[model samples]
Target chain A: MDHGEKRLMDKNQESLFVRLIPFFERYGILLLILIMIAVLHLLQPDVFLSWRNVTNIFKQVSWQSMLALGVFMVIVTAGIDLSVGSIIMLSLMGLAIASKAGMPWYVVMLVAPAIGFLCGMFNGIGITLLRMPHPFIMTLGTLYIFRGIGNLISGGVPITGFAEQIRVIGNGKIKLDVFFGEGAREYIPTSLILMIVIFFIFWVFLNHTRIGKWIYAIGGNPGAARAAGINVDRILIVVYTLCGFLAGIGGLILAGRTNSAYPNAGLQSELDAIAAVIIGGASFFGGRGTVLGVFAGVMIMGILRNGLNLMNVSVFWQQVLIGSIIILAVYIDVLRRQLATRT
Target chain B: MSDNLVLEAKSVSKFFGTITALQNVDLHLNKGEVLGVVGDNGAGKSTLMKVLSGLYKPSEGSLFFDKEKVTLNSPRDSQNLGLEMVYQDLALAGNLPIGDNIFLGREPTRKVGPFNFLDHKKRKQLTEEHLAKLKINVKSADQKVEELSGGQRQAVAIARATAFNAKIVLMDEPTAALAVKEVGKVLDLILNLKKLGVSVIVISHRMDDIFTVCDRVMALFQGTNFAESELKNTSRDEVIGWIMGKKD
Candidate 1:
């Protein structure tokens, strides 16, 4: 080939690699999760890879995983909803009180999410309408307010003995027969199914819809999105509302699983959710995240916590490890974005 | 008067709190005519185009498009009316595929029952066709806009406008980031838009671009219309004087 043709061939080969780069980039977090899982299996072969242990982890973490999904949306908009934990508490306690009053299980489920939605709407209005700076302040204020309300209503006590039907969604599992060597049985928790469904919906919303694109665009650059004539205030309201709705769903599941609703039902859940989102590759600067990333992030967190519990690790050590992971994930995000921009 | 008058603004003025950004600016553009809007920084050039393209509503002014007085409430509204604005930034999502970015908000959708899915195949085919029509060559539609050179991005922006059936395109400093050779490609694209019966309003500080592609040049100084003349008739010195707010 002539020099020009040879150079063109080189360029073509380079671009072919460039095309594959996005697939790797998109699945980076998932890859990290798999590697982590593999390493944990190697270290604790029997317990880490056990079917019972895996199902237990999924059941235990699905509620908080839902909250993490909610926080992911808030963070992507370059905002934080510190009140998500409080909202979850409200959802659980409020649903418990309603159920105790002889409300139908269906009505209880519907009412739980409604309370969460209203609470979220409150935050949305407070920030967008009042023109608050940083969702941190707005959500923080709401966080305290929500927690206070939860305590006042429940009198700092737990309510127990929820209806069996309501509890089934949280504590139930479906057993499947796997043809592995023989007809061995495999079990998947219903919460895992819920988690998967929630993940799928958010994934489609974030990647496919016009509203989803607008959310990212707004978070990426509000000024630019405004110049593009996006209804910024409306989108912000919708995002907060959605976050609240998800928190409420999480609250219901938690209450159902424990067969009780308490003021402290979701205590410290906000921190865990935020940790998961940050660890899943969301940027604090805004407008860069994926639903799948958040899913894997939550799984990584759940797996770590499960592994630590099995190993009899101290609570203090777990906290320290999680904190370090959050920092590392955020650092990785910064590095990835920098590399993306430079060339 | 040209039969091809695509966009007409009548006494459009915009204010920001206490400051007047644009004051009763009357501008006209015809199909296949390349109009250069030359202005210094902060001369309300951006403000005027923003109003015309529906990014900003004039505090006081009316606009006419294709002989109809209409209010452009949003960018989508402007796009529906067959008007497109290519900002200096190009308002492009660099991480997205070139075809996806080209058809960002208004992606062609195929319906199966009530559900509408993005017609990716059709979009890729149309993107390639549009790029080819503009005589701009690229490796593939799947390339992220970020991977492309500045000139290629510009080509993508123009192709997007053309694909959306935009008859009047307001470009803000389209060549500002391009290299010298790339600028030539963009200038050629402007002429190509004229050949396709598209009205183009270009905002540029580059005098040569104003001289090369633009048929008529309009100068703005301190939020006022200073002068309007045929590109060939006006001297570069005179245009510079108008831009600098010189009375002579």
Candidate 2:
């Protein structure tokens, strides 16, 4: 490889870029988040980095992060779950309806994720057993089917919730009375804590467990994984089920925060979750991604939306921007893959 | 049949509805012997390999391990019987590092309480030792399998196949697309397996590879046995004729 004349010619040019961006290959999104924060702070001055504003950003990012984790798992196995946003709305409706029907708060709280797991199982079974050409067709079909059920169940109206535990998990914050002197009232958001905990547990699951490696292997090459005696169908089912389960969690949090689950809730939120996963550097082609990268991706989206608000950017413009960033992130993934294989 | 034979496939036939992929294919490998299988394209070479590896169920046949009747219902069943296959595509996860790929199905775990976590240190140590023993040179066992050259990828595949104390290895065109030097290395690996008393059945189109490492040769032509010979009693020209449908 070194003997190639082209290698010599490119070495001089490549050295400069390599030297300037040593960590750029792996931690590129983290760097992007930092730069975005810096620019936002510069443009908005006092509003962008204030204590309340920072906490608010984290609060906004929390539920989306959960959905992204689920999507990350599915994407790692080289599959997609466009039904996650739909999964959230359907489960949240179930939670609200159950809570409203005189069921205990604890039961409904646990029920939300349970509903999600079942929905994911549907996706998994449809993809693997039904022999769908690809997961996209199956999940896309469910994206409509699940949302329609939510619409039917909720009668296309909002379902109000009245659970204290739900509200606490979604909206409560632990105040630092002694440190902040009560009047100052600085605190850490519960949603933030939940996000970190969920992310940590899943990071361990994906990196340390044999099942985790098998997921990556399936994504890397399904044929090879099967040839190596790994159960490809079972793993695919597990991944989709996990995605639905997390979407259920996201729905629970979203409903808890709002104190209601609307029939039309989570519209296009799945796209946002997918955007976050892509921005975090998970390849659509699969077999590569990190939880940290996806976290950074969630932050990038959260900050971008918040920063746009602070800078007086139009809500419509933010939608355009976020969609464009998803495309850009995916394009970068393509380029990264090319670069990896080239050497 | 010999007492030393490690594996045998008797009267194996495979059918895909109307098409017969294999018919009455008899194959055997003795302990510590390298048997080369040669055939042209669509000559049931890969099909037989797949059947032996339990990727396919033979329409009619029986397999034997150490002269005992056995059934390979799946890759795991074959694996349980110590039958390992080094696939043509290498069956490696390109996104994973060498150590991870080498230990994909059977990863070492450190039990912390009731939960088990992959023991990265032990895995890396063992991978390094295995690669070193195989003379596979790379910067680190942590290097992604995709980052390696064709030869290096082949080395990783071979390292993985031979790692789990496999009694008999089935390699499908192991040296097909490798470099000249890499081909030599693969032949050496085959010999190394023979020295360890492991049986090998390697599929190849190259007579040079068979002559270099194989103790005997077998040929299949359009899903049936064409010829069989010990290397000492046969010439390259005769083996080439066998692959070209010659008999006796």
Candidate 3:
């Protein structure tokens, strides 16, 4: 090529690079997830690329992802629900006790969520009506309170042997007989399906409802929302209540899978859920996240853990790496905000 | 009360602990008239506006809207009674789109299978139409408020207040952050609102803005209403004197 022509082509390429910068910034996390999957596949092609292993990852992450969805909503309002982990334990314990007390399986399902709703209402009232200094303190207080109650009710013992119907909700799978080769079947975990359905419903709610719009508005600037005539306290209460309800569902799934309800089943699970939400691109200060991003975030975490296990990585190192990734995600979010404001 | 009076505050007083923010401050707005509220820092201008906008309840006295006694306990109540306020901070959700912010509290929705969903198409169309009528130049209603300039943000806030067809609109330092050229546009907006038979109460430090739009000027001094006069009856220097505590 001529020197002049080469120079013109270089200039065009540079301009194209500049134009694509914003798009890359917006979808950087999704790209990172894809890259992680590729690297894992290269390291352990047989295991990482297996359909069974992929479905297993989804099943394992389903309950935690449900918790993340709840945390996502709470965080969208610029609030945190530390009590969610404890609420899970409490709901599970409630289910176990109800089952042992001759309550029907269907009634136990309804009661579990109701327990969570009441617990969430307690936190909401403390934060909204009592005008607590911060939601962190209020939820932190309830976390211990709920945990203590769980211990008291269960006597620090794990309850096992739930009804078959309850167990099926957690561990049941849909067998697709026609998908694979002859005499081979593919299994989709019912829990995974439940998580996906919940996520889809919430996605529509957040993007297509007035309440969803109000959630964003309240998170963006609560004072402005109040001035705009929104019932800020009521919405805040509802957000926390919903978080509790979802956490309850997660608790029941965990109980079903384990065939037991331990007072400490969900200890520190809030950290994992919060990490997923943050990694998914939800800002700590609120009002900036997407449902799809959250799903990707949960899947990335699941993939990382599954792949690391296949590679025989120590759990200690995995913890360190995951923690570092969380910090890095938040740091990237800060930089993205700075760049946006600068432009 | 005269039939011309759209709103009247009868000796409203507000106290925060030992601090007296406002003391028996009586004020009134006539229908379709623009009233300018001027005061120095800590002179109870915001406090009075807060009371009028229902962000605060007066410790004493009463408020009458359209010559009927009414109590405003919250911002929602004031809005329901056809009063809207544009705060100095603009009070806009920065991360929300222009259309969402404009219709933040009262969003249009469509019912689907017993569930209410936001009507995005209707909201966008109406927002575009309203902005066009207001002569607000913007790329689209979906543009986030954070992406807009200070002047544009101010225009959006004003449009939100006026779009609801409010009987009375209160503005607190609306042009304090705008460029000189943008200030002229805001002044024109206030004039347009007045022509539509909407009563306006503007609190501004800029004498130019007050002179350009207000029919009457009210001076607040040390938490009290010191003086009020028609624009033709008062000079800028005289009003400045009252604001500076040089006259009572």
Best by lDDT: 3
Per-model TM-score versus the true fold: 0.88, 0.92, 0.90
- Candidate 2: regions farther than 4 A off: A1-22, A333-343, B1-3, B11-24, B56-62
Whose DockQ is higher: candidate 1's or candidate 3's? 3
Candidate with more favorable, higher lDDT: 2 or 3: 3
Clashing residue pair totals per candidate (backbone < 3 A): 0, 0, 0
Residue-level lDDT for B174 in candidate 1: 92
lDDT of 1 by residue, B113-148 (tens): 776666778888888888888888888888877688
DockQ of each: 0.26, 0.76, 0.74
| Per-residue lDDT of model 1, residues A1-343, tens digit only | 6999999999999989987778888897888888988988998999898998888888888899889998899888888999999999988888888888899888887877899999999999999999898789999999999888888888889888888778878888676665343455577788889989988988877776667877777676676556556678899999999999999989888877889987677888899998898888777667777888888889999999988887899989999999999888888777877898786
Q: Write the per-residue lDDT of candidate 2 for residues A275-321, one digit (tens) a residue.
A: 88888888888998899998998999999999998878999999899
* Worst window of 10 by summed lDDT in candidate 2 chain A: A18-27
**What DockQ class does candidate 1 belong to?**
acceptable
Model 3 Cα shift for residue A171 (angstroms) = 1.1
**lDDT, residue A179, candidate 1:** 39
Q: Write the per-residue lDDT of candidate 3 for residues A125-192, one digit (tens) a residue.
A: 99999999999999999999999999999899999999988988788877777676555657888898
**Candidate 3 residue-wise lDDT at A126:** 96
Write down the TM-score for model 1: 0.88
